[model samples]
Target: MLDPDRIRVVAPHFKRRLSGVTSTVVQLIPAQRRRGLGIATLGPGLPETMPALSFAQLPALWKKPKGAAHRVWHARRNVEMLAGIVLRDLLRMPLKLLFTSAAQRHHSRYTRWLISKMDAVVATSARSGSFLKVPHTVILHGIDTDLFHPPEGVDDTIAGTSLPGEHLIGCFGRVRHQKGTDLFVKAMIELLPRYPSWTAIVSGRVTAEHKGFADGLKADIARAGLSERIVFLGEVDDIKPWYRRLTLYVAPSRNEGFGLTPLEAMASETAVVASDAGAYREQIAEGMTGAVVAAGEYEPLRDAIEAYLADPGRAHLHAKAAVAHVRADFALAGEAAALEGVYSRLLGVPATSPQS
Candidate 1:
C-alpha cells in the first residue's frame, strides 16, 4: 500500500510488483504535486471482455489490418478499441509508455506504433529499445533491494562446496520452451552422476499444450535416473530464499531483455551461470559476477556448470563480487529517481523545485 501523497500505477501481473518502487520515489520528490501523477497506460481491454472504446478517438485509427478488420474494424463496429486509445490517450503530449514488448505479437499494432511516437521512452530492458526502434533510457527494471539484500557472513552459512554440499543447480522461474528447461534436463542427465549431490529444482507451472512439456520434462528427469535429484516446486509466490538456497542460478533462455533473475540472484550472493543474453553482458562479467556461455549449446552449457562445480573458490569470489556489483548499480531508489528525472524532463520542469 502507498501513502496518501504518492502516485499509483495499477499494473497487472507481468509488470513487476511496483509498490516498493513507487513508494520510495514519493519520499524523494518533496515538492511533488498534491494531485500526484496522471498515468497513461496500455489499455487493459474493456469490461465484460467486450471491447469498449471512447467515441471521440475513433476517427484517429488507421485502417484495420486484414485479420482484425472483422472483429475490431470500424463502420459496422460500434467502437474501434485500438483507435480510441491512440487518439484519446497517446498523440497527446508528454506520454510515459510503460509497455511490455514480450506480448507485442498479441497487442494491437496501432498501440505499439503509437509508443514509438511517445515524447520519451522508458524501457525496462535493452530489448525494449530494439522492439520500438527507439534509443531508450534503460531503467533496468527495479528490484526491492531490501527484499533481495545479500545475507551477512553468507559464505559461512553456505554449505555447498564443489563436493561437500548438496549439488543443486536450481532454475528459478517457470518451466516452458522459452526457458529451455528441456535442455537443462538433458544437460543434467549428462552431468548428475559425476556429481551425486546435484539436484535440479524447476519451479512454476505450465498451461494447456505446455502441460505436455512439463510431463515430458518429468519423464526425461526420471529416465535419466535423476528423478530423485530433479524436484519441481510449482508457482512459488516468494522466490528470494530459493535463490539463497541454491549453489548456482541457471537461466537457459534463448532470449532475455534484462533478465532480472540473475541480478536478483547476484544480490542474494548466488553465483550465476546464464545464457549470454543482452542484459547479462551488462551485469555479469565472465569471471566476475558469474559466467555467461552461449545460449542453447549443450556442451558449452555443461562445461560452464562443470567449471563452477569443480571450482568453489572461483564461484565464491564471483558470488561475492556479483552482490556488491549489483548493489552499486542496480539500486532501486536510484532508478526511481532517474525515472522521476525522465518525467520531469517531459514536463519542462527541473527535478528540484524552482527555488521553492
Candidate 2:
C-alpha cells in the first residue's frame, strides 16, 4: 500500500477485465516508480504487488501532497476520466486530471466533452492524436527489451506443446475478425504446403461472441488438412517466451489502437510482417526491420510473408536489426521518462532525475 500523503500521481484501473489499458498500467507504474516518482495505482484488477491506494484513501485527495500544489490523476479510459472529473469538480479535490487517448477513430460527443475537462492529454501515437478535438501530446508506447529479448540458444520447441516445424510464424491477440485472424489462417493455408518447414501459431482468447468465428477458422484448417500445421495456443499466461520461439511475427489487425505486438516481436529478435494498422508503420523500418502492407489486403499480406519464408537469411538479418531499432527508439525506460515529464508539468513540479 502507498501512503496517500506521499502519492503525487494516481493511475486508476476501473475495469476488472484484463485489457490493453490495464496492461499499460501494470508495466508503466514500476518503471515510473524507479524514476522516484511518487505514483501509485487506484482501484481493482491490478496485481497486489503494485503500489496502490485503497478506496478508503480517496478522501486524502482533498488535501495536497507535500511539496506539490495538486496531485495528478492520470486516466486512460472514459470511466476513469469521469471519476477524475467527479473528484476534481463535484467533490472539490486537489487534482489535475490527465487522459491518454489510444483510439484511432473520431470520438463520440460525450467522450469529447469528458476529454475537454482534462488538464492535459496524451495520445499513444500521432494518428491517435489527430482524432482528438483538443490539444494533445503524442507518446508512443515502448516495450521492456530485457523481458522480450532473443533466446540464448537454438531451442525451437515451445515448452509445453510439441508443436512441430523448424520455422514458427505467430499471430497473437484476440481471435476475432477485427484482428484479421482469418487472413493469417487463409495465408497459412496457401503457404504451409509449399514450405513444409514452417508452421503457424495463433494465440489469444476467443470470447463467447466470437466462438463461432474461431470454430469456423478451425473447421477451415481441418478441411485443408492443415490442423496439425496451424496451431492455436489459446491465450497463454506468459507471451514473452512465445515471441522468442517465432521466426516471424505478424500483426494483421484490420484496425487497432496503437498496437504493440510488432514491437514486442521485434524486441524478442523476431522479424515482423504487419498490416498498416495502428503504429506499426512508424515502428517498422520497411525493408530493414520488417515489412508493412495495406491493412485488410489478403494478396499483399500473403506475398510479404512469402518473401520472408522464401529467404531465411534475409529474415535473420532483419531480426538482428529489429533488436537494435527497438532498444534505440522504444525502450520502456524512455516512455517512463517521457511520461514523468508530462506528470511534472501537470503537477507544477520540476521533473526529478531518474534514479540510477
Candidate 3:
C-alpha cells in the first residue's frame, strides 16, 4: 500500500509474461525511485522489488498532490495508453498521459490513433522514432552496470550450475525462430568441433508452442556429436553473472524491440557478435566493442564467431573497450535522469537537483 498523495508518476504494464517491456519496467522503476522520483507501477507480473500501486489505490489520482500540477501516467503499451485516456479524458482525473514507443515498424491504425491522444510521447530508439506519427523524445534503454560487470578472476563459472567450459559463448532470449536460435545452433555446431577449448550455451525459456523448435536444436547437436560441448541452459534465475562467465556473446535475433542482451554483454566485459536486428547495430562498434552480421544470415554469423575463436587476444582487447564504452554512454542513472526531466516538464516542477 502506497500513499496516493505522494505519488507523482504512475507506470502501468499490462503483460504478465516477461518481455523487453517488462524488463525495462523492472529495472527502471527502482533506479527512478533511487533518484527521488515519486513513481509506482500499476499492473501484474512485476517483481516485488518494484514499487507498485493497487487498483484500490488508483482513486488517489482523482485528487492531485497539494502543490503539484498533475500526476503523470506513463504507459508503454497501446492498451495501457487507452486506459490512461479513459481515466484522464473520460473520467475527469487530473492525470497527464505519456506513452513510450518501442516498436520499430509502422504502427497499426488503432495504435496510431491511441498514440495521437497522448500528452507526451517517448521513443526507445531513433529507429523506433521514425515509426511514430507523433512528436516524441528519444530515450535509449540503459543497463545497471553495477549488477552486470566483469568477474574478479579468470576461471569464472556460471553460478548455481554444473556447466563447465574453458570459454563459453551464449545466445540468450526466447527459444523460437524469431530469435534466430536455429541459426545460432547451426553456427555453433559447425565451429565448436574445430575449437575444442570453447563451448556454446543457449539460455532462455521454450514456450509450449516452441517445444518442437527447441527439441530440434538439441537433436541437431546430438547428431553432430557435440551435445556435451553445446549446452541448453533453460531460463536462468540470475543472468548477470552468466554474462560475466562468457568469452563471447551472440545475439542472432530476426526481430527485437531494442534488445538489451548486447548491452548487458558489453557491460559484463564480454565481446559480442550480434546480427543487425533491433537496436543491436546501434549498441556495437564493429571492431571496437563487437562485430555485427546481417540479420537471418547464419554464414556471416558463423564467420564472425570463428574469427573470435581463432584470436582470443584480439577478442579480449575488444572486451576491455566494451566495458569502457558502456560505462561512458549507457548508465542506468542517466536514463533515470532523462526520464525525470520528462516528468518534471510535464508537472512543471523540479524533478531533482539538476543532473550533471
* Tens digits of per-residue lDDT for model 2, 20-41: 7877888889988988999999
Tens digits of per-residue lDDT for model 3 on 150-200?
877744554434665568889999999999999999998998878887888
Off by over 4 Å in 3: 154-164, 354-356
TM-score each candidate.
0.70, 0.97, 0.96
Candidate 2 segments whose C-alpha is farther than 4 A from its true place: 156-161
Cα lDDT, all candidates: 0.56, 0.92, 0.89
lDDT computed for candidate 3: 0.89
Q: In candidate 1, which residue pairs get closer than 3 Å at backbone N, Cα or C atoms, i.e. clash?
A: 167-197, 167-198, 204-235
Q: Judged by TM-score relative to the true structure, which candidate is superior, 1 or 2?
A: 2
Which model scores highest in TM-score? 2
In candidate 1, where is summed lDDT lowest over 10 consecutive residues?
A: 69-78
Stretch of 10 with least lDDT, candidate 2: 152-161
Better of 1 and 3 by TM-score: 3
